[model samples]
Target chain A: MFTNPQYGIFVLISATLLTSVVALLVAVPLGLMAAIFLSEYASRQVRGWLKPILEILAGVPTVVFGYFALLAVTPILRLFVPGLQTFNGLSAGLILGFAILPTIASLSEDAIYAVPQSLRQGAYALGATKRETITNVVLRAGLSGIVASIILGVARAVGETMIVTLAAGQNPTLTLDPRVPIATMTAFMVQVSGGDVAVGTIKYKSLFAVGMTLFLITLVLNIFSFWFVRRFQEKYE
Target chain B: MQTNSPAVGTGTAFYVDNTDYYYGSFQAVRDVTLDIPERKITAFIGPSGCGKSTVLRCFNRLNDLIPSAHIKGRITYRGVDIYDKGVDPIDLRRNIGMVFQKPNPFPKSIYENIAFGARINGYKGDMDELVERSLRAAAIWDEVKDKLKESGLSISGGQQQRLCIARAIAIEPQVLLMDEPCSALDPISTRSVEELMQELKERYTIIIVTHNMQQATRVSDMTAFFNAEPTEKGGKQGYLVEYAPTQTIFNSPQMEATQDYVSGRFG
Candidate 1:
């Protein structure tokens, strides 16, 4: 089958943008909640146990997440959202969110912990309650760290490929609706490679264009995360 | 030879009675009792681990934050029991501010450092005037006035300690606790802090803990000597060995331990 060159470029652009938007939407709330839970809610013993468990979540292979998304989450969603497609962005995005939750939680915990003990004591000595101390002192002190973690989570989501390819349907429609099936740039690469496109063809050349766009997107995200962490380098001695 | 003139009449400021401090199973300060006078500087001088700092922390209940630390006994401020269940530790600290041994300034602008305690205590009027007044009172306003916007950490070691003093007094505490406030400073800076202390004593009762015997003799009107007492169970605890006017404590100490310790005979 002859693949149209124009169709390939359009699919690449549509997929990249769709993936980025979905990843960002999922990363923000999940990551922020994870950070708060780990840093503020968890007890020292619970934190000792839960943090490593979260890291295991982050360490789980993308292929395992893809399998979970395809085999597990889709079936669950089918019960409520009737007519939901077998492979959809929602399942993949949710699983990818779980995968990156640890990045947000661990880094944010480090940031919150980095707040000086003296400052916390100072706040408490001023008659501030536990909630007040956490809100006014700990969170304020750790703002830069939290911002850096969110950027890192976003970067991880944007760059993820395996889960998106297996779970997200290879339909390149440029719509914001998570309920509808959509293809991401990573899925397109897998689709193109699965078929027999002759060497040096425009079809083959289209992958390079998609590859370049993905590279730039991930590079920009990486740079952003780096700068954010550097900006808030802990100054307490 | 800074003015040895006793500016304020000797009136009771603090009445720390039968106080005991425990760190888990071990007692750090044992059955201590003493009086601090209003508008005067009282120095606690002792060898290392003699609970001078520990007792100092008790005045403001700063030890409460340490999970293992426990206190029993009465520390009265203006004749009110500080350890009373209704006495808020925060309010107690606000009325009795502290300066640590090492200079610790917030990682903020110099102006904000002085304003932090006041803001926390809900000071709502004349923030600029209050900040300037506190700085001038601490005697660092002239050196740092133009650079109020600069980071507090950017100042010299001596200047940072004074900034801490300003930070403490911004809340207008009735008493100031100094835990070796000059130990980390040079002679020049130490002299400046000593001068500031003398000036501050006119308005606030000052309790200073110093490892330097000369510093205690130079700045305090009264001096308390703490010594380690070995327990039957084989651990050491700290208690007041002697308390007297600085002149008597230094020139004519009543206790052999105080004389031995002060005369460089023993720790």
Candidate 2:
């Protein structure tokens, strides 16, 4: 199936990587900011209410987010972009970011909160404002955790099938423009699995190959995430 | 008016008057009044849970960080009410720095740890010179001169505490509030830091909280003893028992609790 594909499996892999990168480009900053808010700026009452809402967002079915993107997000994008497609990677990537927001925000917030209160007091004692303390001391101390959270979010974005399959279209065209439809790795796998193709054929075996590639990518990401968390867990004692 | 405390000299660095602290609904300390003389080391000696640390924290507004904790009354630094409406706590803390009971250097390089405060304060001076001067003052420069770029946590317990001190001093604070600075160190490290405190007192007003009475007598020019009373609601409230010159508190009779504590009778 690798040889039989229109542009081979590279197109699918690249599409998956591009979509996930775009998703993470949006998710990381928003997630990190939300985390900083929860850990530093938010009062206890606000955090108590805000954290569970993010957790609930994480728990929402990806298919539901995909539906929201299709019926709610794409039309809005079309109004601005003039000729945007009904099913485009832009909407898919955007929705996937929100889908993964809770994963990124909750973990990052926990890490930042775990930064020893002493480091914060030390910074504040030196006349640093809340902003300065969070940026220089809390965020710097929680860097490993924040980076690990983003990478894990990236991995989640890559493996996410229903959202991209339903919202990002099913054509495996290799292009950088997010305005057009593109088939990601997971979307292609879903397309094949939802087919009437017979077992023991190259199409079925090619699914395994794609699955293996996705596994390897996520495995590498998880390994790096693990190393970062273990190696740079900041100790302020 | 003739209480053992001398009249508020021009040397007074902090005047904590009738201050009571609370954590949510529970009162921690009551009616704490004292004058911290400039360029002198004042020690707070007390039993556990006596809120000595709480009172010490008030000098720099560190207790303000705790959401539920509140202070009622006045803490003036150099004749200005620091707790007044226009005063910013951040600005107040700049002139009044703190060192925690345990060593807490930033997880940065030793050089960076010392430079952090000065940099954040927008000091445009030669950073290397300032780092060296601060470390020298803390008495850890010679030990850490070779590994200035190493992480501050890589050092020994005593050295880390000194790094914290150097970090505090790099900001050039007028007062240094050390809450049990040597409680986490070995005897050797403790002695080194105690001596450093003596040298530091010549430049900065030093207020220290110590569980060790000997450490207080050895380093402090003035002493304040605190004690806690058990409340009926299964809580404890702390109060200041006596404040005087270190020699007078140790030798003279004023409060029975002070007499018992220094004489090895009771806490």
Candidate 3:
């Protein structure tokens, strides 16, 4: 249906990339801080109670998250950015970040907590503060795990469907501003599939092409993360 | 408190008086009284589960890491009660360093590993010289000096232990507490570590825990022997059986149990 392959592909790819990048910017720092609190600072009783709450957030269906973002979060965004639309990439991404919080936070906690207790003791015995130990020794030691956690979170954000489909609003013109409407590849596929496109048409075939492209991107990310984890093990073990 | 008791002496590096430690409701050690002298190597020798390590950890308050682990009675370091409410464990630990049974190095470059503690303690001195001097003091400098930028885990197990000792000493702590510093190494590494301890005692007070009776006798200036008795409900409770000069503890122990343990008749 399109004369140029790069014409549709570039804009769609950038839209997908932009949405995930915006989401991760919000996710990584907040997720890492929460992971640090869960692993290092929380007492056993507090951890037991707090962790399941995070899991419940993770367990919430993405379609529900899409609805929440479309209805609730966009209004809040509109209050701050006057140019924000009813359906905007910024709101979709921010809410998607919260949707993936438990994935990043819980996995990062596992990484941080997997650092040997002896390392913590060594830091403590040197008269290092708790912050020093966590940042220098524990976090540094668990670097691979933490990076892997982030990469996995990236993969999740890239592959997420319902939030982008509903809230991002399928208008895939590539602008860097997140307050504008955008169409993720996932959202565009949903848009076309939900409508009446004939089976043999290029519009219908473009769905498979887009699906293949997203699959390739996510596959590369997963492979890279696994490779990183293996490299970490080879060094530490 | 017998007349010939070594505890009678005024060796004031640490004065642990009636120090009882508990893990939750279970008392692990009872009525531990000893004085670790300054600039000397003190060894704690006992069988497994005798709480020798628990007692050694009290010297630097390392046992505080355990949530349910609590202690009663007095432990003084240079006239300050380490367990006092006013004492900050962080400041206390800076003055007292530790080497674990297994070498525990930060997963950083050897240079960074040695420099980390000093940096966090706000060391304003030339770090290169300090890292060199600390590694030299630990006797692993000549071996590791060429690869300063390599990860600490890149070294051999024995060299890693010495690096850990270097990291601990780089902080300029006054006392060094080692929990089985050589239990994980080969005979050659163990001997070198023992040699390092001999050299280190001139600079810092060293307290070590070991299950090896020979290791205790060989390296320590004074030795404290611990023995355990099973409580009524099938748990072991450890207590100090004797404290004496290394020579006396090895050659002629005062208590029957100490004699029995050193003679290898029973643990």
The CA lDDT of each predicted structure is 0.81, 0.89, 0.88
lDDT of 3 by residue, A73-123 (tens): 998889999899988889899988998888999999998988888889999
Expressed as tens digits, the lDDT of each residue in A138-183 for candidate 2 is: 8988899898989889999999999999998988887877888889
Per residue, candidate 3 scores C-alpha lDDT tens digits across B100-178 of: 9888888899999999989999999999999999999999999999999988998988999999999999988888999
- Model 3, position B159, has a per-residue lDDT of 95
Candidate 2 lDDT for residue A208: 94
What interface root-mean-square deviation (Å) does model 3 yield?
Answer: 1.4
Candidate 3 at B4: error in angstroms?
28
For model 3, name the residue pairs that clash.
Answer: none
Q: Please give the DockQ score of every candidate, comma-separated.
A: 0.36, 0.79, 0.78
Could you tell me how far off, in angstroms, the CA of residue B11 lies in candidate 2 after the best superposition?
1.8
B245: Cα error in model 2, Å:
0.8
RMSD of each: 4.9, 3.2, 3.5
Worst 10 residues of 2 chain B by lDDT: B1-10
TM-score of each: 0.86, 0.95, 0.95
